[model samples]
Target: MTIIKFLTLTLGATAFLSAQSSPIRSCGKPLHPKTIVQNDAPSGTVSKENKIQVALLLDTSNSMDGLIDQAKSRLWNIVNTLTTLKYNGKAPQVEIALYEYGNDGLQDENFIRQVTPLTQDLDLVSEKLFALKTNGGSEYCGAVIRDASMNLNWDGNEKSMKLIYIAGNEPFDQGRINYKETISKAKSKNIYTNTIFCGDRSEGIQSFWQSGATIGDGKYFNIDSDKKVIYIETPYDVKISEYNSKLNDTYVYYGSRGSEYKNKQMVQDKNAEVQSASSSVERTVAKSRKNAYKNDHWDLVDRAEKDADFISKVKESELPADLKGKSKEEIKKAVAEKSAQRGQIQKEIEVLSKKRQGYIDTEMKKRGNPEADDLGKAIENSVLELAKKKGYSI
Candidate 1:
């Protein structure tokens, strides 16, 4: 071939190749690889450093004051820990929801409340917990899970994960709301239902709650292991150690979220610290990243609204006719299919993220803070390089 002709051919090929690439946001650097990008589809780090909607269904049964207080006290640490995750340049996206069940009984049959929808506002969750009170009954764990499944505006979590934390003294199986059906719904959406069994000596409690967790693709923890302020007077230590072990075992502790909630924290102090963290240059990046997550989540909601509208005949056909009230295991068939659509959408979001990042960079430059720029860039560069070394090519 003539040299000129060959050069022309090569240039054309390159342009085509570039066009085929996932469009990256031209705004900022691709988060230096080390930082996580919001909306990275599953990248196997949903629990590690990405967005997750965590629902805390506490058991405020007459027998469980201890667990409620412990949950309240632990909120800040949990938030601090989650914020440390850098999934795709974004802090772990978090929206913690709350519910109370097993506290009401067959007379009223069931009572459920969504104290908070999925939200990044940790303080709101804490405030809601403060109002929690012990109610009636031996436990109706199923009701809470069902409520969360039926109510909360769950994030699609195709880009993240949805976790249901159920703490109660009763066996999960014995309730009007079937635990099996709840588990099914969770599985279909990749929603995990981790259990925190609080009561004692109930027959088959282990099988009921543990099995629920198993089928739901989640874990179960002995609430007794988690130190409860109410339980300290009873001689048993809150097994925060055991709790940490589960996170470690599952690799959920990657960003030091486990450590942040290690001890009692005064509300004022926790809030102050969070505020300070918010203002730090490093934190500013994290905040921006968090906002990126919100944008992406809404993007998915919009897509789902458009694609199936989540209600198209095609979408409805994909759902099991008897899909209603299915347990987590039974719901798996549907979740698997939806995953493909999510994967495609996620790639698009990643490209857009890169472009958006460039805009952020431009503003940083406009600030004209040389040392600050150097520090941010240096930090970002190291993170991205390390991520690439780790095989992400970020």
Candidate 2:
């Protein structure tokens, strides 16, 4: 059986950053300079599990607003697609880092900013994407790629798929840093660097975009940045949307950022709805994916269920008002109830989402074969292919 079919068959059975400080002398030992460190995993217990790390470097010059919009609209779809991937029967963790280059408003002289470091919190990634603004500035492909490679803590696991997808319309050699050296460094670190040019395919080839991709054994593509993404509304969209709303009710927020994070969840929901009903439905489907939706930090139920000592460690003041004054057994029972409800809702969404995907797949086939050029399709195709190479069944 093909790897893709193996992954689909398994699903059919189951149904479902850092900082530093000044050094000081202590106990006759000299302290070293405060060095900033970056971690690939989010804080908590570090697992030696395999993962897929993607760094997205976008050119945010005035003309690239369409690219940013596409990223915002397609982020959830990308996450949903990755959830289908598995290695040795275990789903790999997914983390994404975001960078914006070619924006004059950025304080860095190079006009590049690390918008968000590698993180598992997908909500934070969406928040930063929505906050991005475009301005005229230098487009330094090499410089941004070098900075991300050196600064972010990429995984040392040779089996893991680590990648950089840098998209822009500028010439590949526009910056002071040598493109060859930068890409070579990325290759040495086992990071595959894919380049996406926002223009004609021939123009991208002439501009060295294809060469840049070749330097790191990556794929290159040209996309029409201004092309609108078409999301079709399936018959199951309404029920799925309703189920999503009910699923949100299963979350019980706690901790200091509980209220704020809860509000952000609703805000993202609105953001997707404003784009299109189809986009919102896509997000609902993503939330149903086993690996795509996670809220352990601020959601009391998830936190408690994930960590054995989480409930005991949480301060009384940090608990949500509804959970306050409740006994330990009562809180545990309540959280368990919410968790069970969440699982049932997610299963329902998953059943409907499979139908939705089949419909979309049939529609695309009817539309005839078309080359993948847009940001979403390009990344999705590249990721799936590369992941398969790394022994992931997609």
Per-prediction TM-score to the true structure, in the order listed: 0.47, 0.87
Candidate 1 to native Cα RMSD, angstroms: 22.9
After superposing candidate 1 on the true structure, give the runs of residues whose Cα lies further than 4 Å from its correct spot.
1-50, 105-108, 199-207, 225-394
Compute the lDDT of residue 393 as modeled in candidate 1: 25
Clashing residue pairs for model 2: none
Per-prediction CA RMSD (Å): 22.9, 9.1
What lDDT does model 1 reach? 0.42
> Which candidate number has the best TM-score?
2
lDDT of 1 by residue, 71-145 (tens): 543443233223333445433445666666655532345655556655644334545666678766656667667
Error of 2 at 162 (Å): 1.0
Candidate 2 segments exceeding 4 Å error: 1-48
Q: Could you tell me which 10 consecutive residues in candidate 1 have the lowest summed lDDT?
A: 1-10
Question: Which one wins on lDDT?
Answer: 2
- For residues 235-327, could you state the per-residue lDDT of candidate 2 as single tens digits? 898999999789889989987778888888888888878877777887787666545456787887767767967876777788888889988
